[model samples]
Target: MARLNMRRCPQSRNPSSEKIIDFYAGDYEVNDSPIEQVKLTVPITDNPSEPVLTFRTWVLGLTSCALLAFLNRFFSFRQNPLSVGPVAAQIIVLPIGRLMASTLPTKVYQCPLTKWRFSLNPGPFSVKEHALITIFAGCGAGGVYAVHIVIILKAFYKRSLHPVAALLLAQTTQLLGYGWAGLFRKVLVDSPYMWWPQNLPQVSLFRALHEEQERPRGGVSRLQFFIIILVSSFAYYTVPGYLFPSLSALSFICWIWTDSVTMQQIGSGLNGLGIGSFGLDWSTVASFLSSPLAFPLFAIVNMLIGFILVIYVMLPIAYWTNIYDAKRFPIFSCETFDYSGQVYNVSRILNQKTFDLDVGAYNSYSRVYVSVLFALNYGLSFAGLVASLSHVALFDGKHIWQTWGNAKSESEEFGDVHTRLMKKYYDPVPHWWFHACLITSIVFSLIACEGFDKALQLPWWGFLLSVAVSFIFTLPVSVITATTNQAPGLNVITEMIIGYLYPGRPIANVTFKTYGTISTNQAISFLSDLKLGHYMKIPPKSMFIVQLAGTIVASSFCFGTAWWLLESVENICDKNLLPEGSPWTCPGDDVFYSASIIWGVVGPGRMFTSAGNYPEMNWFFLIGLLLPVPGWYLARKFPTTKWLGKIHWPIILGATSKMPPTRAVHFWSWGAVGLFFNYYIFRKYKTWWARHTYILSAALDAGLAFMGVFLYFALQGNNIEGPHWWGNSNGDHCPLATCPTSPGIKVEGCPVF
Candidate 1:
């Protein structure tokens, strides 16, 4: 084996200089590419002369995440049924799941098909190992199946898809995502300035796993986790989703309302609602956009304000003024007070977008919000960069400079031979690689999408317009989402785009009319991946592959599943099926509309006339737009701030899904739990108990995935076309036309007539 070289230095007595030099010394290397390392490792492994991870181990690692994904989809208790929705859940669950498996004797890794055909020596419950598997599963089989089961099976009135096909789709998608990521590992991961914060948790876990192996083993505990997932899944399938609704408090409430129609219509729909259901209203979302309470401490405050001003304040005002709905003042279209004090058409109002800003009613709302947020975020993110550097300059500036200089240093385990070889043959790819990869991926995606009949039917000019819109919209949107975590601004950007390009098309018609507009969403999602890579210490090159893999996996299946689920509907009565009022009813529409509307309305701004005036609501949406900044600023001021720093903003950012009355308490509580587990359980009890958090999380996710899958299949209940439960069907319940109906299904009185 070749050796890595360490740079020798003259003796220095100055402590500050010494520290800086030493810190960065390791970063300096002749060659820093992981791809080259891969090539070298390949030769060694293929020689049959050097020890390497066996094929069986590779398969075991790969399949583990898949298995977990399947379980999560089938057994979920959250909106993201696969339980991979929240980053915190992933961090907490995956390790625990793996640890649970770890404690289960050799049978855990046993191949279900061949049964212990091959095995590798133990590596501790590895964060990297399991995470890779989870991502693989998520991107591959999980991604595809998620779409397929939700769309095709449910749409066709089938209970489920062929198991083999589901698995194949999942695997293929994952592979593709990884392949794409591989092309841009350098910029996303290797760049020092680009450390994605979300990745740090994973890196810490991975490093700890390796370090812990040297310590005595008390073994990982899986009791609480294992039982939780099992019980959760069982409960999910047995309760509202499968068996008739039964809840003591709810039952009492129902009794007070003797009207079965109201009860059946309203209460029946409760099953599909999650904790975040309360916050889905325009007021809540708008509030979040403008509130400065939610901003990160380290992020600049002014840019956030600007963003809020544009979307929450400006666009809402615009849209409400007659942009989209000429005759309405943006009230809940379905909100009707009963003459006798009984609710009439309550569902329609609940179903309609509030203030005409609902993503469903007017495309402008989504576009304007996202666009302004993106622009604001892009502008504000620069401040974050300044903040980060200034913070470092004040504190760890020396260390950063050292790390920068050390990029030329040799690997610790390697000697001169390896170092020389690395210098000669391996070099870390540059940041430009990602730019190139982005271009290529876009091209390929366009090509692939063009092959689809519906997508291909788009005019060539429309396709070019879509790309232009995506390029214009996604960059800023990605920056905002990345820096602030709240992307309410996307709404504005999307509306502007759609309103400009496909001017008279219904918001629903944009996807069919524009071939590649959705790429804006994809770009942002991809950028999030890169953001994650930056935080973690994973090699930039390695991260490129990992992220690309996940993306490819997601892309391959996301659209298909979205399409299927949107088109499929089953029992209209089943709340889990496209409930009378839920965003999931129109799965892809919000995202697609966000882009199309932007192109149509804002892309040309004053130049191109719009079909209708955009609606205007209150400027309250600007509140949360600034909220994230203060918090970010405070964080930057106090990087070592104990309680706050311990709270991973990524998770908190995700928690924005929760409504305000509940958001603060939930965020802090969850943060408390996470911090306690990470610091106390994992760190303090480092010997055994806490190390397997990811494994546990994986198991939980698996259970969740399984439940979600089950709901998608079984809940349809033989109905082929009623309402799509998974996404954007815009109908309540299953999409099936002939779903079983009860007398209570009739409206109390028709108000629409």
Candidate 2:
């Protein structure tokens, strides 16, 4: 309970500071630098005495968390899963903060017993308090991906779980990441070079909102522009989102050739590759790929190149060429199939008593078949894994080593201006605090893994091993993400390890992967938020408290929402059980369940090794490792070729990161928007790009999220249908999108009432 005195650094005499030197000097030159020149010149203060844990922060933070958790979980069940990102929370909470600041009682009120006296108003809603609210909302924004485990069990696998047990599973998995974030705060948050490039926009938005004294020369101020965009986006969403739903996926090609199976496969957004498709909906554009308007131009270009090469060029060639008789299946799908082109009957292959695979039944059912695109996704994942390691080593090893070597130095010369400013104000959260959380998290995980039937059958040693793996990979992943805005996930690695260690236990495999991979990802994300706090000068202790509280609140809401959806949505995952063209297809759960089968039930040995049917996929790891070598060598040999240095293999491989749930058209559309703004607009109007890009993104996201929630409750949630029309009908547009061209495969059609 130690309080640190916060102080602002004296403003430098130079009004226009052009250059600021730091230890990682060249790292930012390639992409958007976290410590921009504009930020250094601005006079900002870190006020540590500001009330951050006041009633306003808690009320607004919890409310935002509850709403975001519920909405994100609800959307996850949809065919096109969308998430309410942290940026949305960051933007929406600003007005709420201002409202609280204006209406709350100014007089101090004392607690009944404790010596705590705090004002509900807390004097003008400090930036730290606003950030604390965002941190809480962020904890709930994505609604704990691990909760899908319980959902998949109950909804897809027909194994019901106790609500309390489900909540604990979600809470423990999420909080484990917080422990890792706490442990790595020094390396990932305190370090000057750990900029976490994605967080720059949020930081920029914070400064624009709180720091600006007078309106700029531009006709519209940032705040005014943001509000306008938010209102405009919200109004526009009603058309594509609910009324004229066809606008969400406008495929002109499908309209032209409605009966052509080939065209439908290439053009349909809902069922196929979505080649010529376009969405009027901003939410559709940003759903899986994220807001492209926020990405750096160079990164977007690299991803686009890779996406086109893989999905458009390579996948089609492989499918049409009948690689693995791929023509027998749909060109793009996550569902597993039998060799006879029928949906794979998982229940038939599983033992009735023990959830293990029945050898005789499995042999009789024939080898499980995967769509070519699905198999290729695994290959790309393998490539991405090795490519990330090699790319980071070749490009970032020197800077990482240098930063580590100078870790003990408190010299301002080695740190960014923000880091130096922070040093003057607040002390970093104590390491013991992180260790305590880590120990507690481990205890909870052990109890869950051992005590609950719904929980995994993972041993204590296995749980520790997952944590150890997370620790080992955290630094490298953090470094990559901090610099380039990309982190190759630990999913494949974790699943492979656990699959080898404990085969035939699908629950244990997924649980281990959840703890190992998701924890690392969540830790990096939390650290990124902390770095944002550092830049904004939020007290470390307050950030910690809000994050922990938010995670707990999010867990409860997400679990409850998921449970409610499962109970109401009949035959959630089974297409045969639901009405045709129902939006509630559970694609995310399909992908998750498919992974469980591939890695957990069948085991990695049978999927990638010589014993497996698809042994050729093992070559991708070597290919990924070697892919970056030539680029690195060329950059070293000819240093002047700037483009060579920017050829990031990890970004290229990451283009296929979410293939199942995300279509090729999502990348195409995202790349187009990124090109329009990040590439063209950024070069033409740097100031406008800096000022408006993130605000625009935040506004659009907030609008979409809020409208989606409203529409769901007003119409979909209550089972109240809008007026029936072609525009409002299931917007597939193309009946033959999922029809198989290969002989002996059954053809499908859209519902025509």
Best by lDDT: 2
Q: Which ten residues in a row have the lowest lDDT in candidate 1?
A: 39-48
Task: Judging by TM-score against the true structure, name the best candidate.
Answer: 2
Clashing pairs in 2: none
Q: Tens digit of lDDT per residue, candidate 1, span 195-274?
A: 33333333333333333223224432234444564456445533433332221012222234344322322222122111
> How do the residues 632-701 of candidate 2 rate in per-residue lDDT, one tens digit apiece?
9999999999999889888888787788677765666777788998778878976677667877887888
Instruction: Estimate the TM-score of every prediction.
Output: 0.47, 0.91
Name model 1 segments beyond 4 Å from true: 1-127, 141-491, 506-554, 557-703, 706-753
Off by over 4 Å in 2: 1-49, 79-82, 86-92, 109-116, 162-164, 211-213, 216-218, 453-455, 567-570, 579-584, 729-732, 750-753
